[model samples]
Target: MSGFSSWSRRRRRAVIGGGVAIAVITGIGTYVASNDDLRPLKVDFVLGGGDDPTEYGKQLKIQGQFGGLAVAPDNTTYLFVEANDETVMWRRKPSGAIKRIQVAGMNASRATQAAVAPDGSIYLAAEDLWRVSPAGEATRVIERRGCGKANPLVATSISDFCGATVTGVTVDKAGTVYVGDQLIQTPPYGSYVHRLDGKSIELVAGRPAKDGESVRPSNPAVRKGYDPPAGTKAKDVVVPDVTRSGALAATKDGVYWNTGPGIVRINRDGTLSPFVARRSPGKISDPSGPFDTVGRALDAPVRSGTGGEPGDGLAAIPSRDEIYYSDEGTSHRPVLEGDFRWQGVESDAQKKLLDESKTGSLVHRVTDGKLAPVIAGVQAIATSKDSLYVAVTTDIKYRNTPENSATAVLRVQLPEKN
Candidate 1:
């Protein structure tokens, strides 16, 4: 009787344990179904040293420096271009070995941007736009005539500064390539975005200004009222503070470039309209104060000394109707000792953008009325279907300086079904 009773108790315990396991699993599944955070999608794929250098995806490691990055349609292969370096292409296999794709006589100083077509053809900007090969041949898509002397950065080599300085590029499923020209030299800065589709080139905004005939901003200096930190240099170039703004992404309706402080929609009909005007933190306007003070604030490494918050890069989550961008944190912030500054860095803008956020480099998702940060410290970013890759440029060494340390690329995986 004792033995039978003991066996019965063991059986009962097993049944209870099995029931608990089922309940736990069902609860977990329900949680995952409803919670984005709980789902495995909220994670980042950090690929670097020790992580299979090649297994993550096809990586192309360019020599001189990684200027721009683009992913192929199948989402398995990647193309990385190093601007201004003769060793232009670095291709990484699915295994771990990286191979070099050579482009003969392709010379570009500050070859700052790159993009991939739906057909897998690559386009990169140096002084001009070059059509690159998946297998390794490079040809000119557009060439600069007189603008070659100006050393233009071709966002759209189509007409060469027909709009402004091309600083950004994107493509759609139909192979339509959109280039964003930083028209800082001309007002209503960012008045136009250029589009390149096959043999045609067109502007996507207000009237196209005459080449080199736009309003330019004056140089910045330390204001009598505002004193910069010790050793801060005064700015000499007073050019407009329009940064390389906008990123290209496709939507069900059509292709779009998110530009300006607010996200503006560029329609196929050539109409430019406000898509999300008053969204989060609102568009950080050009800071107003003594121009001298602004200049003093701008006196940073990158901006040198200027009082403007130029918009940088942009990206979007199609189904979410949400767009993300890198806003120059220098909008309203005061000058700090450690912040990165160009010739015309704006002090106030930095303070404004960094008030709540810890890392000025931030990621924001567009909600109903405002833009917010999703991640910060993003220097350069690219997306492969379900993954977002961000390049965080950490340590630096000047010309001829020993490479003490280098920046790293962070991979964030977008939500995917289990």
Candidate 2:
């Protein structure tokens, strides 16, 4: 009887245990199904060092100073890298070899921006827009042109300051390319967004101003671009400020970029509008236009004596519907070296933009109807299948100083199913 009773108790206990296990699993599944944070992406690895590097994505090793990172349609990450005293196209293969991809008929100098096409190719913006296929085929599109000395542009007194064109490049999912351009001379040719479709190129938005014709800005300094003080020249008075396009990213949803203290979105229909304007902690009247708050405050100007302009960084992860950006922390915040005077108009604008400044190098996201903080001090960002990469750059370097030798790529892993 005793043996039988003991066996009966053990069998009953096993049945209860199995029932509890099933109930617990069901509860956990229900929780995960409702909680997005439960499936968060973890930090994977930081790729930096010699030619042979760490593999974060299958068989892929990141090498060199990665300036622009583009994730191809096949989920392969390609970096427009600056190294070995020149710029080169670096792509990681499925078999884990890091190789330099030579695009025929194209040079890598001045390749500061890159974008990926829907068909697994890449475009680099330099002297011209160069397209390279996944199989190493190359073609040059949109021949870069600078307004000549006879273009009627008034030059600046800043020694050797001359005309410039083609600031950056971005491509939409439909294979349409957009080039950002501005006339750096007087008469202040306004910023432009030009469209390139196959064999055709034309202006889709932004009108480049003619002599004595520039868009008058609500900001006094910008208005001053059109009308300089009694004695100062326009080119000398109208310095590069926060109002120009910094970086760009595109999606089927729309094209997004940072102009000065604001985020500008261009729709497929070619409508250009400010999505969010950067706000400084000073001056109370809601910081202009239908704008959203950039959390770093007028953070850039408050930290005076800082190098670089504000809003110089931007990136996007289309699959996640998220765009990450940074404020170079100052708007039109100019740093003068050797024998420079503080002009009245410029100082007034800086004072207004920087008043009550809250300071920090911030990283923020634009998604849904919000521009919120994701990280701090991450001045630049890029994204691929299951990872996000961010880097911080200081404006301490002078012109063309590639000898800095810092080539670190920090990767953050996420629970990305794709």
The candidate that achieves the highest TM-score relative to the unseen native structure:
2
lDDT of 2: 0.43
Measured with C-alpha atoms, the lDDT of residue 32 in candidate 1 is: 24
Question: Which lDDT tens digits does candidate 2 get at residues 294-379?
Answer: 33322212221255432244667676676666544432211111111111212332222222112224455556645433333332
For model 1, the superposed segments whose C-alpha errors exceed 4 Å read 1-64, 77-84, 92-98, 108-113, 125-127, 144-164, 182-191, 208-241, 244-246, 276-311, 319-321, 330-360, 367-370, 398-407, 415-418
Worst 10 residues of 1 by lDDT: 18-27
List candidate 2 segments past 4 Å from native: 1-42, 46-64, 93-98, 102-110, 135-139, 148-164, 185-188, 209-216, 219-246, 279-312, 330-361, 376-379, 384-387, 391-406, 413-418
Every model: Cα RMSD to truth: 17.5, 18.2
lDDT values of the candidates? 0.39, 0.43
